[model samples]
Target: MQIATLAIIGASPPVRLARMPHIELPRALEDYFAFAETEPTRNGRRFSITLPYMDGERLDRLQWWYHVSPAQEQMYEGTGLVFHRTRAIERFCRHIERWLEITAQRFHGEEPIPRLGQQASSVATPASVELTPVDKVVNA
Candidate 1:
């Protein structure tokens, strides 16, 4: 006699990759929001996304990997396991989503800055200069 066990896993959560289009960007990150775009593409047999660097500088390309399920795998045989179903693929997608959120906030300047305008005054300057009245003027 032979014994075999089978297990079933629940369906995965709704996940999608958000795409970003090309646009003119600032030299420094401070002016990022001046040009930024978001583009979304559904996961399909050929599931892959590319992030472009707006600046002219040469840099490594950013790529993401996705895994598809057995059923989906069979449907798209030539596409390979890169886009086939797997837990690692789902985890990668989740991480990418979180990264996108943080990147957007950073580029848009949504992140709060500490002590943006608050500064402490020092007493090193002369007392007369510090106490000078704005309405009063001294003859040269």
Candidate 2:
């Protein structure tokens, strides 16, 4: 999973580039990442990804922040998985794999539930391979 530059399709002028790999999460996990947010701060960039948020059930999403400092330092402790913060992106990817494993068990081998926070009534259009810097695809 080497980092690569992604072109910002349909982005406004002064286009931005995200220095990350194409995420491999699928289905509901895919939808969850679709709403992922990236905030540019004076220190660096902060990327946020979260658990399934459908039907407006508030379950302390504030704890899911992902921070990347100016020196390329990263710290992220998944709100649902292990609480220990990690600087390695591969560890975070493992966090996602762990979530998928548990979620599959939770669903009893059925398709993972769509993110409840989106209030999506359907599970269509999972993700975007290309997009603008701030683009968010609504599942509903």
Candidate 3:
């Protein structure tokens, strides 16, 4: 199966792919928001949400996040599962595939992706990250 995309030139997190056949993003997202322990960030062109979930009887353990940046001429936001101790988010994504493995591709597939803005690698980052009140993120 072929994957199609409409990439905006010079955009940080370019427009989301036109859906992949093997990936179940809808079910993945539904599982993401259903019972995610959300940490609200500032709103506007730049915002982020960090969810640390261990277990909820109905939800699985997943360190996930969703973020958007303004400085990169970003017309779209970014999201994915956190790499926690070799744990695959596919457990929540309802599909079998590493999140970044497939996403980190395109013309720049072979290049080393830069680590921008201190993005978290594992389920936990340093204390420099500040957290605020939880709010429903409605991007419009």
Candidate 4:
């Protein structure tokens, strides 16, 4: 199945990614967030949630992938599965919903960073990312 990883940029704990396609993301994401070695880009910070395929509950391989950059207001999405399969499409949709739920919880509101006499302007707000087309990513 082709799976897409949701990403959120500019948020605290600046790196987060889904580890598996079948597993749901935890409510408290303290230890679940991940960061891979990627080249620096104009976007503030890139957080990825890559979803690998499951073979009857066992992870087989990565098929589809997604990368969201809130700073750049962009989402890159792609899949590698052949078009002849319908299961891949269904799995991808399920992954997308789960990803959205996790993102909503992680970035619900602007909880200002606590600092004595800090200017409000210095605070950051949630912004939309631009969508970019990409090829599916494989785990290295």
* lDDT for each candidate structure: 0.34, 0.37, 0.31, 0.35
Tens-digit lDDT track of model 4 for 14-132: 22233443234333222233324245466533333333333333443223333334432342222211111123334554554465455441122112211112112435887989999
Q: What's each prediction's TM-score? A: 0.24, 0.31, 0.21, 0.21
Off by over 4 Å in 4: 1-34, 43-45, 61-140
- Global Cα lDDT for candidate 2: 0.37
**Better by lDDT, candidate 4 or 3:** 4
Query: Candidate 3: global Cα-lDDT?
Result: 0.31
Q: Of 1 and 4, which scores higher on TM-score?
A: 1
Count clashing residue pairs per candidate.
Answer: 6, 7, 0, 13
Q: Largest TM-score belongs to which candidate?
A: 2
Segments in model 3 whose C-alpha atoms lie over 4 Å from true places: 2-57, 65-96, 99-140
In the range 20-126, model 3's lDDT, one tens digit per residue, is 33332323232233233335345423222222232222323334433332333232243212222012222433331244335531111111221112222346655
Looking at model 3, report the run of 10 residues with the lowest lDDT sum.
Answer: 107-116
lDDT of 4 at 110: 19
**Residue 85 error, candidate 1, Å:** 11
